[model samples]
Target chain A: MVNLGSIWQNLLASQAPLQSMTGNATTMAGLATYSLPQLPYAYNALEPYISAQIMELHHSKHHQTYVTNLNNALKVHVAAIASSDIPAQIAQQPAIKFNGGGHINHSLFWKNLAPAETPETNYSKAAPSLAAEIEKTWGSFDEFKKAFSAALLGIQGSGWGWLVKESTAEKGRLRIITTKDQDPVVGGEVPVFGVDMWEHAYYLQYLNGKAAYVENIWKVINWKTAEERFQGSREDAFADLKALL
Target chain B: MERDISDSRNQSANSLTLSLSLDKQAVTMSASLFRATPVARSALRAASAVKPAATFVRGKATLPDLQYDYGALEPYISSKIMELHHSKHHQTYVNGLNSALTTIAEAESKGDFTKAASVAPLLNFHGGGHLNHTLFWENLAPASREGGGSPDGALGKAITTEFGSFESFVKQMNAALAGIQGSGWAWLAKDKAANGKLALITRANQDPVTGNYVPLLGIDAWEHAYYLQYENRKAEYFEAIWNVINWKTVAKRFEA
Candidate 1:
């Protein structure tokens, strides 16, 4: 498992202006900004399931805008804090939450998707433990898929559907949940995988056929990543952020 | 605009007293803050500048009454979809808008800019939703009444000039509606910045048409607007909605 906590700690430490002045090359010059993470595979890697057009726009345009906005919001937030302007600080919160969650969710989303027909796409083969856990919870993999798909369709507006692992006393327990807008899975829950239900995610290819989009998403789901997230700590699951830092 | 505000104030008078005090407190605070600190003046100016008109007065945004029955636009838009869209979806936006405005007012009164700023997106979203739906309800009439057919006079001439022909305008508007990336609206608006020329525009996620464009007609592109009746075949919904479009309302806005 990746020791992402140390990396995160180091990132926080590197944010100090002193660290930049001390010739710490690893620290970003001046304020550290969260940059967009590169996709694990080519843009067309998930083709037929998700079109090249959708992938290109979703990543290069939509996700990139979120990353850019998040960095800008963070910069403004830091300035607001320094000046002790409470309203300015509060004003920045929504943008921070929206763009930050967008970045985090998209980062997790890209990683949890693999090229169709890959070993990672085979749930039982790549994720026996997670498959077993899913079967235990929802009776079978097919049943779990049905339940998750239903949750996805049930969203009224812009949102995401997530498969999460409960933390603490319910560590191994799994749940399917939906979050409105760009809300991330919070409260110590580990997001095993998330399927973005935002129209931009599928609209270019599927048009209005959301059900078909949900059905085909399973074709590209990376069970290897699911199993890894299920078995490891939350830190391990979010180690993708290290690249952005 | 003054008449509309007065009418809305009269309609919401019973519920206005509590919130009116809150608004007065907020206005008073901003005025005092304008004098007290130079640093806060810019923030307050920013806050007021982007603040929606609905937040200024009249307590809360109440759901407007439909002139016709929910089933009035039947055969085109189902009664079921109309009911849910107006009552459930639009009501949610109204409640959210009110709550966000109240939060902002209270926060500003206490000099908690953080709290006021935090609710800004909610203000934009719900306020836009309320205003859009209110306009949308008026933009439709029972087909037997003023709905359907083609616009006449200046609005008709403007549409022809902007989009070639009435048929072409309808085709282009439907295309615009279909091409929307997410939950949003496609609008036929008057561009105040360009000498009231007609324009076609789309807003993502309940963003009100503001700053130069006056939305004359808007077609919601959200799945909920059509999913119950049309399902995934939203092209059908887009086509059918025109049969119920109140060209009179569009013309009124255009002429205004």
Candidate 2:
């Protein structure tokens, strides 16, 4: 049965959305939220490879919109509960979930990207530790990129690219792999490197031209961030497999 | 059971959920490896790792090996069905494939399309047979693991993007297969048109849905595959077979 006292209060309300900006732990009664995150890098920095117009639209319009919808959904979610319309509340979950996640992922995405202005650090040489790992196992970095890119470009449609770690039967060593869509290798493979190939990701700047964007993104790739991801991925992957041994 | 973690590859039960994170605080990067015994491993390794020796069967192909045992497909497929299908039906295709290939090679060497044109049907039948059987084994799982349901991860995402939901994909495949009146197989080919990688496609019959698609997942909708057990119940077989789907293999293929 409906426990009007406890269930209504709890069900009518939702947990706070996880946003780093709200530094304080205090809650705002019904539900607290954060606003759209401004881009750390200027609009025009990416240039011809990625235009300022695209960046402005992508960050300001696309991303900010996700934030707006997320907040709007939460508000409706609260009203639906207060009115006690279970169906209305139930139906709103997916929009809330998708927009909320979209907001979160895009926020992180903005921070990861920067303009291709000055010299950008890329995986000119895969980091030594990761490189040594790949060399010892897969033979050469070129071969690794070929195999990895094969999986990355293979994605059928709009989705995030992933670099997953997996163990081959012969080699107990960890190696990176690629996967399509929302699948993250179920948390085993931390995303050390990625490129969002979805049309919305680069359509404005690169248009239907995927090849150009992929080629250009390499120049602006933040390899150091990818390296950190690789480090974190290795720490968990090897030891986790050892348990089976 | 508590102290000793089991070998994941041989995991017979379906509760196995492949995750990248375990309590050990490790990054996950694994798919289920099914090779348990050295013998199974050796044969599989030979089959999988045999550097594309893929004997191009020119005409009607045949069943290769059960790997486990001829009786292995028992219960689901039955030894009676396998014996006849393998020894009789499949053997016929193998013999035919060899003949067509030899004939084609001779014609090509002699620069004669006239002879090869006549042999086109033979190549389609036999080549299609070989391709189908080669892919069949790769698609199936043992009885314990049968009943492979919808895919997850990147595989699931692709299927969803390409053809709505997983159930919808199955409906399309089933409809496409059912539309094949006489004899043929159903396939979910690895599509590469988008990113020059894997794409899912279905071929009608002895026609290998040619071009490029890594034959990652397949099903023998031909009556010969299940008429013995279900007898005109192809739909039932399709439903039952989903349980034994070697998702781990499919996942690995996608990852590869």
TM-score of chain B of 1: 0.79
Interface RMSD of 1: 7.9
**How far in Å is the alpha carbon of A14 misplaced in model 1?**
24
Q: Write the per-residue lDDT of candidate 2 for residues B203-239, one digit (tens) a residue.
A: 5545555544555677776656665566444677776
In candidate 2 chain B, what residue range of length 10 has the lowest lDDT sum?
B1-10
In model 1, what lDDT does residue A217 have?
A: 98
- DockQ for candidate 2: 0.01
Q: What would the per-residue lDDT of candidate 2 be over residues A123-242, giving only the tens digit for each residue?
A: 544355656666676688678766666655544333455554453333334545543322223333454556665445665455434667777765665555555555664444222222
TM-score of 2: 0.38
- TM-scores for all candidates: the values are 0.53, 0.38
Give stretches of model 2 more than 4 Å off.
Answer: A1-29, A78-90, A115-120, A124-138, A164-189, A232-245, B1-256
Colliding residue pairs in candidate 1: A86-B114, A87-B113, A87-B114, A90-B114
What stretches of model 1 exceed 4 Å from their correct place? A1-30, B1-256
**lDDT measured at residue B76 in model 1 versus the true structure, 0 to 100:** 91
